[model samples]
Target: MLVALLLLVLALSNEVRVNGERGGRQCGANPSLKPRPHSVSILEFGAVGDGKTLNTLAFQNAIFYLKSFADKGGAQLYVPPGTWLTQSFNLTSHLTLFLEKGAVIIGSQDSHHWDVVDPLPSYGRGLEVPGGRYQSLINGYKLQDVVITGNNGTIDGMGLTWWESFRSHSLNYSRPHLVEFVASNDVVVSNLTFLNAPAYNIHPVYCSNVHIHNISIFAPPESPYTVGIVPDSSDNVCIEDCTIATGYDAIALKSGWDEYGIAYGRPTENVHIRRVHLQASYGSTLAFGSDMSGGISNVVVEDAHLYNSKGGIEFRTTRGRGGYMKEIIISDVEMKNIDTAISATGYCGSHPDDKFDPNALPLLDHFILQDMIGTNITIAGSFAGLQESPFTNICLSNITLSVNYASSTTWNCSNVFGFSDSVFPKPCSDLDNPSNYSSSYLSMLSMKGKTMVSGSVSMKK
Candidate 1:
């Protein structure tokens, strides 16, 4: 009777597991939980959450049904608790994909199932390589009022196979991102967890009015090209109250790639990033560009914290990148154990091809950094502009840093025109005396304070 007793115990355990999954369907009170007249459950579409069943057709049918009811206030697709394996699926306008707690949408590992899409017009090719790109797990294109939020549910990209292919140099097309919104407008992605993205976590390209907050993006420290959130060629974007720990830049703002981008001429502007906590083992806490050719302007980054990151507040663009980065403001930043506190370099990464124009020099101007504090910094700051096109109107104020390395070199400035006040370890002579322009400098300080306060209020909403 010993064997019979063991079998009874096993059956009881399975019953408990099933009961737990059924009971914990709701995580917390979601704002989108208001009674919807047109709501459907994925279970009704024969989606088995046994963690092994391929639910691609189930998801497709559900989305098709929702699309049919688009004019009637759309539909809400509820994903219950379990691991639902599915391939890439297109998103619909005015549709809400809500996942209950313990529910996970797992990306299919088979590359044959993914759809390949054409390259972006501004990029001219895939971001990492030429030719087309594989679609993201959750793809939305030219849609309006899309909402991808849930009660802390997860969208897991089982990226080991893709990452292995990239490292082995056997990739023909570009790897897929976790969630991408292409040419869409009025998007909201919040209250979710993204893990093990194949490349970038969240990429919103050529979109407008995007709001990303209350999320956590994570990957292993050794994962390559796993950037956190990228707002590429988008405008009026706000990212706040997020914790990002990734292998690449926690937030990399881009416009486009090289000469192809110059012809497109769509600039990314009016971006506000605040209250972000970043942890990076291999990349920057905040990186502007290595591929900014469509121009990036009117960006503000404030009230950020970085821990053990490789770099901090970096602005990088190569020679062929003809974009202009201006009117950027950074304030109230605290960093610890960072390699480089601040950097603005004209040369950072390589161009897409040799056909890129050598005469295209990026313009960097009107950059201000104030009230910055850091500890255990390897290098205080490095600002190097192109000799032919010097950076103009840069300013630094109320900076305090403690260098860990025992080196005579504290600050390196070249081909830049700016001023510094109350800066530690001294500043390069390229910066003029602040007393010479006290009136305008004081006005700038006042403006910075106002911007910071206003940004905080706006970000909370």
Candidate 2:
């Protein structure tokens, strides 16, 4: 019995290593890479407290100590078992936040007390920032080769109080996120329990070679909450074996920013999310936004389980979001009580407020959804904009559904099995375009087996 328990605990451990760019195994146990060269623990840098209340001064001292250490390259910062409360913390290259068992890092809930600086300076290991410009809040400039792992520890964001205020004001001055990794490379965050984020749960922006695994992310179940993972035009990232429950999109990928994306020459690409379980409060379980800063490509989501999500499998782009979504492959997904099984819509016309100007592009093409099973599919099919872009080369195969026929429209299409007459057909085509075909094409894309739904073969034309 003791051996079995130990094996179970070992299976849950989040040990990550240098995995290849979508072609190699995670390198934690690989003998090729050695341990991090140096370790600078936070306890050694004056972090105080025994897992409770305001340890603000201790953390401040640690930051200043890290500054001195940064002058001569960085070192790993370790936080042992305790509940330490503070505003925010910064990470530099070669630094690691190793939270041992029973350690809890709690954030203060007061947004006004939470101060942040603008355009955080780059902390490049060797690259020099411009002489005049200093760093921004939580400066992580050019930070690379870092790992933040919480083994049986909790990183609490104390966000319930802020969530209440966010409901009152949607666009009022928002607070900073709980944890953010910006402009970094070769970063890994695994085996942590992140809860009650003030804003977004995790933001890895403009990063490369990033991996996040086995994180159990939790937020408020009510409405008007934030997202789980907002990868703003990031590249070469993988998030696997995580449990994300949020009010907004569970995982949101932002790429094209109207004119900003094209000007910056950056698009969110090469992302893979697999073996994830998500439960959303309001928004889609997995979504590509209408506010994509650049464009996104080469994304794959497989072996995921979603429970009670507001919507599932969504692709939305608006007039200001000019990025295209293509080369997406979704397979072996199981969902329960979702609003939309699949939704795709694009932007039309233009918006001048966006800094990254968007151009017209296909909403979704070369997308495949295979081996998906779901129930309560309120919105079952794909929707393309009439005035905007149309989805091309979209295919759904080996999908099975168990929905009420009275609420659904019809279900029968090429290559789809196990749908019913109640399934609705979301029209996908360029209807609002004057030059293209104006007529809308609406059809059910899957049919239920006769033994599955009332022993009748309901055909649709």
In order of listing, the candidates' clash counts read 0, 33
State how far residue 105 of model 2 sits from its true place (Å). 1.0
- Residue lDDT tens for model 1, 1-461: 32332233233324322322231111111123343458888999999998899999999999998998777777789899999999999989878888888899999999988899988888888877789999999999998777887899999999889889889988778999999999988777888999999999999999887888889999888888789999999887778789999987899999888998898898887677778999877889899987789998867676789878888889998788999988776777999999888989987887767778989999997777777899998888898999988887777777898888655688889998877766786778887444333344334433543342233211111
lDDT of 1: 0.80
lDDT of each candidate versus the true structure: 0.80, 0.59
Model 2 alpha-carbon drift over 4 Å, by segment: 1-34, 50-53, 63-74, 119-139, 170-172, 347-363, 410-461
Top candidate when judged by lDDT against the true structure = 1
Q: Give the Cα-based TM-score of candidate 2 against the true structure.
A: 0.74
- lDDT tens digits, residue span 389-452, model 2: 5566454545676564645443312221111111224222221122321112111111111011
Query: Where does model 1 exceed 4 Å of error?
Result: 1-36, 435-461
Q: How big is the positional error of residue 3 in model 1, measured in Å on the Cα after superposition?
A: 86
